[model samples]
Every structure is written in structure tokens, then in C-alpha cells.
Target: SQKTNIKALLASDAIGSTVTVRGWVRTKRESKNVAFIALNDGSTIHNLQVVADTAKFDENTLRNVTTGACICAVGLLVESAGSGQRVEIQAESIEIYGVSDPEKYPLQPKEHSLEFLREIAHLRPRTNTFGAILRIRHALAYAIHKYFNDNGFYYLHSPIITGADAEGAGEMFRVTTLDAKNPPLDETGSVDFKQDFFGRKTNLTVSGQLQGELGAMALSKVYTFGPTFRAENSNTARHLAEFWMIEPEVAFNDLDDNMELAEDFLKYLINYALTHCADDLAFLDARFRKEEDKKKKEERAELGLLDRLNFVVANPFERLTYTEAVEILIKSKPAQKKQFQYEVNWGTDLQSEHERYLVEKHFKKPVILTNYPTHIKAFYMKQNEDGKTVRAMDVLFPGIGEIIGGSQREENYEKLMARVKEVGIHEEEIWWYLETRKYGTAPHAGFGLGFERLVLFVTGMGNIRDVIPFPRTPQNADF
Candidate 1:
């Protein structure tokens, strides 16, 4: 029979039966006459303990069974006499597939800082913290697709390279294969973009919302789950040069409908993690508490990991206009005491401090702030009749400031084009996008959720880079 994964073997009820398990050695201990190896296969957090009598194995084989080594252990499944585990393996025979040098292996049977683990990202998955985070990340992703599909949303694949700038932020990574030292210049002194590979300038997509809207126009509801790039030279804990985004666009949906969908979708994802990733979550929860214990007592979280997630799914998100939020913040102790770094203002963008205050301190729950100032939002957001704000909304979680940002799109062709032009976007570049509104365009809305931020919130990871396997930040693209 084939070797069983450690996760299955640990959960198996077939005690006294023979089984073979293949995994990496997390830890090994020698008790003079017997050896115990903690083996993990990446299927689950718990390791299957394999007890081997020293007399049954050769000296060379026992010596090679060190941390980070790969091995195959054929043993009898027996009830564990240990305190932590229910079952373990009584080794009949052991095969050392690969030996890891104790001095060469960066990972050992010790606690390592997140910063050190990032330096060795290729081997970080073997760590308990990262393993739990990745498992939870997978569960969240599965829940995202399942929720959208069950609701009849078509999965749309947006182009990785695009000419359109969805956010109009002008912070995009250009994709060009033009020779830097050679020819290819127009009559003007500037390099000719027309002579480039795409026959024009092109770059990595900043967002898939624009293409998602195109799909939604036909499919009624569509979603895009893929990588998005930004060229912003920010080194914040929250910013990433390249990260995955989940953007869902729905036609014939108003701002309220969009809010409802976002709330439901977020709840579904959190609930799914709670149900499917219980063990991983529990491990991460304890890990979070250990980290929190180092902080000041006043800085501790009010709710634990599972409680926070359950609170989000069980309770309704508090909804209010951005203007109203500003009014509340202006009168807040932080503002009144002048403790806020950014002063509370009616028209300016809300900073992370302000967002966290609203969700964590003021509301003490998830908040959905709507009707952001038009000048701060993207051009696609529907402008209000008062010409001051847009139908934009941002869903702020307790720990994560802004988990989702979405809005009702401008269906009016003339208004959208005027805004596009006012924003200095080349009119000819997005003629196809404009044509959608020119044709039979219906009211629509969508929002984007940063996938890594969700993982950070769920796993209680402090840094965005810690949750992602290979983080691409400013000046850091290490594998």
C-alpha cells in the first residue's frame, strides 16, 4: 500500500494496524536506547511521533535522523502513551531519504523571528507559524470562489498586461522589451512607445476592476482573482509591490447592493476559515497571544482570534457615510486631544489611524463607511448629485483598517468620460471602456479586497510580508 500522509495517520482509528508514513523530521530525540522523531508532512499542524528502538536501526541511520531531514518510517499504528497526541507510530523500519546538516540547515528545533524566516522564504513553509498561515490562506481562497460561484458569479480572468490604468494613480510597473542602449526613437527626442513590443506603452495591471466590469456587463456578475502590481515606493508593513486582489463586479447593482454583497462575502470567508481551519486557527491564535504578551497591557486585543472572527460573522457591520464618520472623529478624544497625526477633515482622505480608531475604538465592530469625497476616489465611482462625494464605501475590520474598498460605478457615459478626462487619463486609451457606458450600460458596482491583508487579519500576523510566502515589497523581491 502507498504511504499515508501524517495527518491521515494521526486521525486514523485503525490502531495496531501497520502503516507507512513519509514526512520531514521536525525534531528527533535520543533516549540512550530508543529514538523519537516528530514528523510532519504539511497536511496538518500536528506531527506523528515515531518511536524507534535504537537496536532496531543502524547507528548511521539514527544519526542522520536530524531536524529538517526527509525520512520514511514504516511502523505499527498504536495508541499513544504520550500526553499531547492520541496516536503515534511504533517504527518497524526507517529509511532516511535525505539528511539535513545541522550547521547548514537554517531552520532548527528552536523559535525563530519572522524577519529571519523571511530571509529564508524557501524553507519558511516548514515552520509551524507559516504552515498554519498558508493553510488558512488556502481555506479563505477556496471560500471566496465557492461563495461567488454559489451566487452565480462567473469567474473572469483579467489580463496581466494592460494599457488601461484602472486606479489612475499613475503608479504602475511598465512592461517593455525595448532595447535600452540601442535605437528605436521617434522623430522627437523621446523614445517611441509605438516601436515597443506591444506597439504602444503597456504595463502590469494595477487592478482588474475595469476588465471585471466588462465581464459583469455580459455575465451580470463576475469576479477576478489574480496578481496586481503597484510601483509605489512604499516600505510600510501594509504595502506590497505585487499582491493578489479579489475584485468582483456586478451589473444592475446599486451602492447598497454592493455593500450587502461585500458584507456577506467577507462573513462567508471568515466563517469558512473558522469551520475548516480550526486547528490552524487555534495554533495561530496561541501564536498571536504569545506575541501579544510582549506588548503593553493596554495594547492587547479585546477579543481573541476565534472570537473576533465569530463577532464579524455574527454581527452586522455598522454602516455610515464618510462625512458622518469625520464628524464623529472630529469630536473624538484623539482629535480633541490632538493625538491624531492627521487632523480630521471633511474632504481629505482618511488615514490608517483614523480607520483603526473607527473600527477598534469608536465602533468596536466592523464598520462600512460610505460616500467618500469624490476628489479622493477613482474616476469610475458614481458621483453624488451634490457633486461633493461619490458612492464609494470602505469596509473596515477591527484589526485591519480597510479590508475592502468598492463603490457604485458611473453608468452615465458623458459623466464618466468627463471625469476620466478631468483625471488626465488619455481619452483615446480607454475608448473601449468608454464604449461600454456608451452602449446599453446598466447601474453596476464592485470592490477589491487585498488577499494578503485578509490573511494577516485572520492569522493575526503583524506584517503583511509574514503572511505571504514570497513578499515583493519595495527593493525586496527575495524568493
Candidate 2:
């Protein structure tokens, strides 16, 4: 008989039917007459209990079926006598594919810390915590594609390596084929990129929005979901050297339309998690509460994980302009009491603390702040009539300050070029982007949702690294 996954077997009603199951051993307990083997195949959080009669199997084989060992069991599925699970397997024969020495297996049966698991990322998936997280991550990715496809958006494949700095941050991982020791150099003593593989300087792309906009211009609606890199040296829990970004560009969308799209898109994802990933969400919610309990009384979340997710989906995000948000923050208790580490100032970028104050303390829900200062925003954002602010928007979540950042793109060629010059970005570097405005520009808007950040919020994982499989941080890139 073909092998049945633990997830299917757990939900199955085929009592008394013989089934073959293959998975890594989670745990094994022995009595004089019988032994119980807990097995998991990464299909679900729950493990299948395989009841084995010690008299029927070889003693050596049974001894080898320790934790982390891979085994195949031929058994009869029956209603479990245990309380936690519905069904279990009565093993007739056991075949060991691989044996893990009990003395050497690092993952002994116990609650392991998230930091310790990060060190052994290769085996962390076998754990319930990571298994649930990865499953939800897959579900969210599926929902993202499904939602976009259902809403008439084409998935665009943007290049990973590019020459232009889309965000104008100038922090990029340079891609080159030249010898690092001593290579081509110009008379100016600068390492000449003209002789490089691409014949010009290039780096790993920071965002696909610039290329995504090109697709949107033609396709009317397009989104790019791919890996992006940043060369920032910051080693904070929130920042990653490499991460995934979901950027959607829509033609003829203004700031309000952009805000609406962002709000609806976020709610859809959170709702999908609540509906399709209930088991995983329940597990994570318990984990989230434990973490919450560790915090100081004042710092604990007002709503639990599920409550927070439901609140976002059921309520409309409070919308305000950047100027208005600054005013609120200025008069707020945190700012007045000098609690905020960064001072709240007009015409300046809002830090994560300020954003959290607005979303968590003031609004008590998701908030969308719009019309940010032009100098503080990207050059692509549409310039407003006030001349001080651009048609930019950022969606702030309860725990995560800014989950999504987007704006109505600047459609006027002259204005865009002026901003480009003002920002000191060479016209030749983004000549193609500028040409789009000159020829057939329409009011288009888009936003980037950090894929890991979304997963962190959904999984209620504290560190951004915990959500991603193999995180690339400042000095670490282990498997």
C-alpha cells in the first residue's frame, strides 16, 4: 500500500484499514510489553502515535528507533485510545531508513529555545514550532498569488541583478566578475566597472517596483514577488541582509486608491491565515501568549494573536496624513513625557516607535498615514499641490510599524526629473524609468510588503529571522 501522510491519517476515518506511514521519529517510550513511537512527516503540527508490540519487532531495531530517526511503519489505523489525537497506527512491522544515536541527536524531546533552533536551522523544521510556521508561510504565499490572480493581476518576474538603485538608498550588494585583489582601474584610481561582466556597475536588486511599474504600464496591473538584498550593516532583529518583497503596481491608481488596495490586500492575507491555517495559528497563538507573558505588564499586547488578526480584518484601518500623524504624536503622552527615543518632528521621517504609538496606542488598530514630506519619500512618489509632501502612504500594523510602504507614482516627466536631480541620482541611470513618464504615463501606484515581516506578524514570531528559513543577517549565513 502507498504511504499516507500523518496529516491525512489524522483526519482519516479509515479505521481498521492497514496503512503505511513514513516519517522521522519524534519520540519513543517503552513498557515491558509495548512501545509507543511518535512520528511526524512535516505535513502538520500533530504527530501520529504508532503503538508497537515489543514481542513482534526485533529488540535491536526497536532500540534504533530513537528520536530523529527515519522509519517506515506498516500498520492498521484505529481510533486512538489517547485523548489528544483522534486516530493512531497499530504497527505490525517497522523498517528503519536511518537511525539517530540517542546520545548524539541534538534535538532531544524537550522545548528548545528559538535561538538554539536558529543554530540548527537544518533540523528545525522537524520541530512543531518551525513546521507550523513554514506551513503558514506556504499558505500565505499561495494566498498572495491566489488573491492577485483572482483580482486580475499578472505575476511579473523581475530581474534579481540590476544596475539601478530603485529606492535611491545607494546601499546595494555589488555583483561583479572582476578580481577583487587587483583588477581593472580607470585613470581616476577608481575600480573601473566598465570592464566588468555587465560592462557597468550592478548589484542585487533592492526592490522590483521600478521594473514592476514597467509591467504595470503595459499589463494595467502587475506584481513582483521575489528576493531583494540590502547591504546595510545593521544587525537588528527587524533588518535582514536579504529578504523577499511583494510589490504591486497598478495603472491609474491615486493615493486613495493605493491606500484602499493596500488595506484590502492586507486584510485578505490575514483572513486567509485565520481561515485556512487555523491549526497552525492556534499553535502560534499559544506561543505568542507565552512570549507576551514574558514581557512587562505595560508592554504586553492588548489583544492576543488571533484577536489582533481578527481585529485587522474586521475593522477599517484608520487613515490620516503624515502631518496629522505628527501632530497626534507630538501631543501624545509618550512624546510629551519624553518616552520616545526619537523626537517627533515635522518634515522628518517617522521612526518605528512613532509609528507604533500611532497604531497601537492611539488608533488601537491598523493605521494608514499618507501625504508624506517629499524630501523624506522616494522620488517616484507623486508630488502633491502643497509642494511640501508627496502622495505617499504607509500601512502600519499593531506590532509591526510599517508593513507596507507605497505611493502614487510621479507621472509628470519634468517633475520626476527635477526630483531625481534634486536627489542627486544620475538621469542616465534610470533613463528608461523616466522615458515611461514622457511617452505614456498614467497615474500609477504601488507598494512593497516585506514577505518575512508579514510572516512574522502572522506567525507572531518576535524576530524577523525566525519567520524565514535561512536568514541572511550582518555576519551570519549558516544553513
Candidate 3:
């Protein structure tokens, strides 16, 4: 019995040959004499059409092959008599492996809203939208590893549980074995972390950049692909309590080199998706256009999914200093009309609105904003000659504001220590990190890319939770 998946059978030249296929039923329509079943195996977004004669199977067997039911169909592949699909399976024999009751099945033939799908996360993958997103997600991740490996970068696995808060934001999920109701208390009447499993305090790592930098220092170039956690209680569409991050660190690379690396890496990922996931991308492109059609005329986007991806890949990203961006935003009509929620200033951090304006409105392309004010940036960033600014860069895309944030690291021991002390970050916590600067520290740079954000951007999904399989938001942790 030569069994074949729907995807392979659809693509094969053996159209006149018989093959056995297994998949879940997406929809089934019955005529007086024949039944047409749409079957999806999760190998592709498009379903394989199966035509079964009522005379070939018992009535009870025909009744069991409903939506969401599992079945094995032995059929001959032939050119489709239908309009939409290229091929269809003419079933000679059929077996119902599992029957799905039509009344209890959550998924139906009708298109369900994304909001409704989120409630049934377990079964959402059976839908076309999520299946396409997941396929693209896998392709993108594979492309990332291939690009890094081909570029002489080593894959570095960083610790998920780290003692040091890399971002210094103090927003971390504590990984503790201590009792929640009544933990060990010190003389200060506080819950003592010293008595915990790891001896001292520990929490989930917010970013692997610090550990990635350490690997780069020894191995020249390294990249980390791992899950990261944050305890931030924000319930926005973009914020996630736990998420995966891609961080690449390179030694002997300055801010300019860092920008080039990030740009090339992102382009590779986009191009890879286009080449490998053509069918899925096409499906998503059509889906995006339909979504756009529903929007008000003025609210719709300028470019569709494919055009946007091609535009980003073909064009060079606009480069400008953060100071220049702030200056331009300050002089823009939004600021003049008092339309901005957050006021634009020289030293203040740029909000999502300001970044979007610079990217989507002003630049009309991907823009790299460099040399940010030191006070607003991380402590490890190299201090610029201006004393007030640091060598930092943020890659802002058209719809997704800041996709990447990176900087040339400070190799100077004293300067790094001073910045650490200035920021009130305890030096003892990062003593090993300081030692790298003291001994044979070269000018290094790295950046962190939120994987979910990238997935959201590529899949044209509105919410970050939709791209990730099982989202961990502030209040919701359901699988």
C-alpha cells in the first residue's frame, strides 16, 4: 500500500495512479449519488478534494465522515473537474478512523473570526490562517539558523534561568522552590531567597544578549534563539509575559557593522519565506487583501503583503540619527497640531507613535535610527564622543515600529563600570560581565529581535498572541 500525503500527491506526476491518504475532514458535501469531501492533513493550507460514490460505502460510514472527523481514503489522483483546486482524489475505498459529532465540533465549514479562534487555541491550528502562520514561522526560523550558520556564526544556547537581570528593568518571573503560603523569612522579616534552591535570588532571563555577548567574546560571533520571560503586567496586543527572542552578538564589530548584519539577516528571513513558503504566502496575501477590503478606504494600508515584502527586500533602509528623527518629529504636522500623545523632545524616549510616524509617514520605508541619548539607553552601550549620546541603533519597519534595538558595546572598563554605577545597577551582580571588558575586550555589538513581533509582521497578524502557538499574556496562560 503506497500511502501518500495530500501535498505530495497534489504535486506528483502520478495523477492516474491510486494512493492512500489520511487526514481530518474539513468539510463534506453530499449529493444524491456522490459525496465530495475536503480533506486537510496540515501539510498544506489547501485541502485535497475527495469524491466518493454513495454505492462504495455504507450509509453509516458516510454519515460518520463529518467535519473534524479523521479518515483514510484510498483513491486515484486525477486533474480536478472543479474550478479552485488543481487536482482531486477519486476515492475507491474509504474508512472512518474517528467520527466527529457535528453538534459538538467547535470548527465548522464557515469562516470563524480570529477572536473566536483564540478561545479554542488547542484546535486553532486546524484553521487555514494559523496553519499558514505556523508554516511561515517554521520557515523563518530555519532561515535564521541557516543564515547565521552560513555566515560563520555559532549557535549559542543561553540559560533560561539567570541570576542577573540583563535588561535591568527588574521585570522577571521569579523561579523559586520556596513555599508561596509561608516561605523562609530572614531576620529582616522578608522572604529569604538565600534559602531557595540556587542559594541566592534568581529569575527567568529577560534577554540572552548578555550571555550571547560572552559567547561572542570567546567564539568571535554567536547567536541565541531561546525563550525569554518578563513579569510586565501590560495586557496590550504586543506585550507578552513570556516570548522567544533572537539575539546575535559579534566581536570586533562596531555600530555600522551591527546595522549591516541586522539588515542582511532580516532580508534573508523574508526572502527565504518567499521562496520556501510560496503557497502559504500566497494564501496569506489573499487573506490580507480581504482584510484590507473590510477596512475603511482611508484606513487601509498602501501595499499588500507580497508587495510589502518585496519592497523591503529590494530597497535600502533609510538611515538617520535618533537626534535627527526626534528633530523631524518635533517639526512635523502631528507635533504642530498637538496630535501626538507623548510630546517629542531631544532626551525623551520615542514612543511607538513617533517611531511609526518616522517609518510609515516620514521615511516611507525601513529606517535605522542611530546614536541615541545615553541616559535613555542601556548601560553597556558604547559612549559616543558627545558625552550625552551613545552608539545605539533601532531598526523601524513601516507597520511594526521598532523591530530591532542594538548598540556598540562599551569595551572600556572604567566607562562601563561608571555607567553601571550611574544607572544604579549593582556591579556585584554582573562582576563576570565586567571581567570581559577588563581583559581583551574588543568593540562588540549585538541586537535582540522579538520573534513573536517578527512573526506578527510577516504573517500580517494584528496581535502578537496570534502568531505564537500558545501565548502567555499577563492573565492568560492557557495552552
Candidate 4:
């Protein structure tokens, strides 16, 4: 058993106290008779330094113990009066437990590209940046659960496979047990597999919103947090083939109520990440600490500095309606003319460029755009009194556009059925959803939040692939 708590001991007045610690060596420095090595046990980002006599231990062992080798050391906790850090452990005896092969290991002390890191997904967690990202990921997940639980929302598990395409966009990745090489054929040239999966064809679910709505009809309020797949062919920073989605549906609620819920929920998550994951956040902040380091030195010399971490943690997101946002974009026509891929039309679905401009330049903060054209949106959206637009909204952040997409659902069966059919999907597939309105439908609303996009926004991470553990993209499943 190790004799001391590395965290407490390093943080205490107990300098030069006997202790023992086991961790993988990050790096080592050696001189004629003395040596210093940094050790990390995944306890925190800061490494504990162990000082030892190079002449005392086995010479061959010391030389062979390259980077990434696991070792145990009996040492003394001493104040690091020399420099670098507060305090570290001074060693008397060293023991090697595991040997990491030098030639085969991919990661070294130097920087590695994101593309290369994806190739070594399993080993990437050992890096400080990924470790911090994952820790924040856990904190964010817990915050989601905590916020919903405290607010009287039931956590509901929805199915992974469904017969209906809920989003009305056929981006589902099909699932089948039938042979791809030799599929059952009808007299027609096309393959007819009605005899698959007990009868009708099914595919991986694109969203749990429909099933979640069922739970809301029965229980008044429900939220589903699980994996959703998309077969989108575009190789962009914003799209992922398979990622997690958070859907919260409510009964007796309108679009206004839904918008309020989304804003509050997002604020709660950002607050949680900043509060609960301090060490992780610090580690993340440290990666961008060059400016901070320069500022600290300049402080004594009498100068001003920009506190980036403070700004991120305390910043309040701005909000705007869809029509208002469009007006702002139209005014910022210069930025749009050169940058946007598509023209910024008034009633058309807001392109990613328009969304980014509203949040990143015009508002200078996150903006929630509400009330989009019904024809440009999904069939389930509630129609506005204007006779053209729907009660749809998207939450756009500074760096990422449309992190969340949600709205008020059509509670009236007649209107909903009409829209569903007009959109050209088989109404029989969502017969149960339509029947919810028939039984005793009340006003209901909800939203779908992309989990990876949120992570990217919070971390200032440039790529969606960096936010997820093992990204599943088109023709590239490296893991």
C-alpha cells in the first residue's frame, strides 16, 4: 500500500515525509549522481517529480526505463524550493513493474496531429488534452441528468431500431439480418424483404423524439439520451455518422415554454462544467496558457491582460428570434457576401454561414433563432399564425451553428396528419403518434441537442471528431 496521498501531501506542510507512489513515467532528467523524473497516475494533470541518486539504483534498469514505463517508488515528500512546481516526492528506492516498448509506442513528448491521434484512439486518452476533454464530457453528461431529474423530468430509454423515419429526411443507416450478397428477390428486379425482422424492414433510429413523445403523452414529461445514427455523406467538421442525442419532450407545453426550457438547460450545463470539473478545466486552460503566462509576468511590470478563462466561465449567451437574426445578417451583408456558400434569403432555412454570423459577429454571443418557415422544416412542427412559418428554433453558438434544433409539436391530429402526408411519408408508420392526438392531446414541445457539438463549443475544440471518442465517418472506421 502507498503510504501517502499524493494530492494531500503535495498540497500540505509535510515536506520530507516518507511516501510511496506508483505511476507511469512521463519524462526523466539525469545528471552525474542525481536524477529527476515526472510521474502521473491519472490522478490529475500536474505530475509529481521524484528525485533519486542515479548511482544508487541498478544502472541498466535506469537506462532501460524509457518513457511510458510503469514504476513504484519509496520516497519522501519535500517542498520543491528550487523551481518549476510547488512540491514533489524525493525517492530512496525504485521498482520497475511494467516495461513499455520504446520502438512500437506511437506517442512521444512532441505534439501529434488530430488525424494521427484518431488512428491511435485507445492510446490517445493518455494525453492531457483528451483526458481533460473526457473528464468534462462526464461532467456534462451528469449535469444533463441532474438538471432534468431535479426539474421533474423522467429519464426514458427509447429503442435503437424503428420502422418509421421520424425526421422525414431519409438519413437512416439500414439494419438487416438478410444476406447482402444474396437478398430475397421478388418477381420485380428490386429486393423485397418484408419477411425480415419478423415482417417489415427496419433501420437504426435517427432520433428518439417520436418514442419520447409517447412517454410524454403517458407520463407528462420525459427525456431520452442515447446514440443516434445518420447516413449523411458530407465530410464536415459538424457532422458525425453516429453520435449521442438528448431529447426532452413535455406535455401541456407550447413553443414558448420549449424555448425557455432549452435556454435554461444550456446555461445549467455550462455552469456545471465550469464548477464541477475544475482540475480538468484547468488542464484544458493550461493548453492555452501561453498568453496567461506572459500576462502574469507583465502584471508586476504594470500592464493590462485578457483573462480568457474567466471570460469563458462567466460569459452570458445572447438570444434573438429567427426574423430578428435574419435582419442582423442582412445588415452584415459584407461578411456574408464573401464568406457564405448560399445566399441569405429571408424565409429559407438559415445556412450555416448566416447562423455563424449572427452568433459570432453580429450578436457577439450565442443566439437562439426562432420561428422558421414550415416548408423548410420538419412535418411535426407547429404552424404559426402567419400561415407560413412554424414554431421552430435553433440554438447557435459562436463557433458552432445549430447545436440544438427543437420546436413546438403539432398537437392537433388533423393538422399534423395533413402536414405529415404533404411531406410525402407513409402516415401509417406513425399511426400511434397521430393517435396520441386523438386520445386526449394537450399542447407539447421539445428539442434535440447534439452531444458532440456541445462539447466542441465548450472546449473551443475545432473539430467534431476531437469531441467524440472514436468518430465513425464515411469509409473511415479506424478504431
lDDT of each: 0.91, 0.92, 0.91, 0.80
Worst 10 residues of 4 by lDDT: 298-307
CA displacement after TM-score superposition, residue 289 of candidate 2 (Å):
1.0
TM-score-best of 1 and 4: 1
lDDT per residue as tens, model 3, 1-479: 56988888778878788889999999999999999999999999889999999998888988999999999999888899899988888998899999999999999878999989999999999999999999999988998899999999999999998899888888999889999999999999999988999988889999999999999999999999999999998887777899889999999999999999999999889899889998999999999899989999866878998999999999999999989998899889843437678888999999888898888778889999999999998889999999999999999987788889899999999999999999899887889999999789899999998888888888887788899999999779988
How much does candidate 1 score in TM-score? 0.98
For model 4, the stretches where C-alpha displacement exceeds 4 angstroms are 3-20, 187-189, 286-317
RMSD per model, one decimal: 1.1, 1.0, 1.3, 4.3
Off by over 4 Å in 2: 334-336
- Candidate 1 per-residue lDDT over residues 90-125, each given as its tens digit: 998889999999878999789999989999999999
For candidate 2, write residues 65-167 as lDDT tens digits. Answer: 9999999999999998888999999999999999999899989899999899999999898999999999999999999999999999999999999999999
Ranking by TM-score: 2, 1, 3, 4
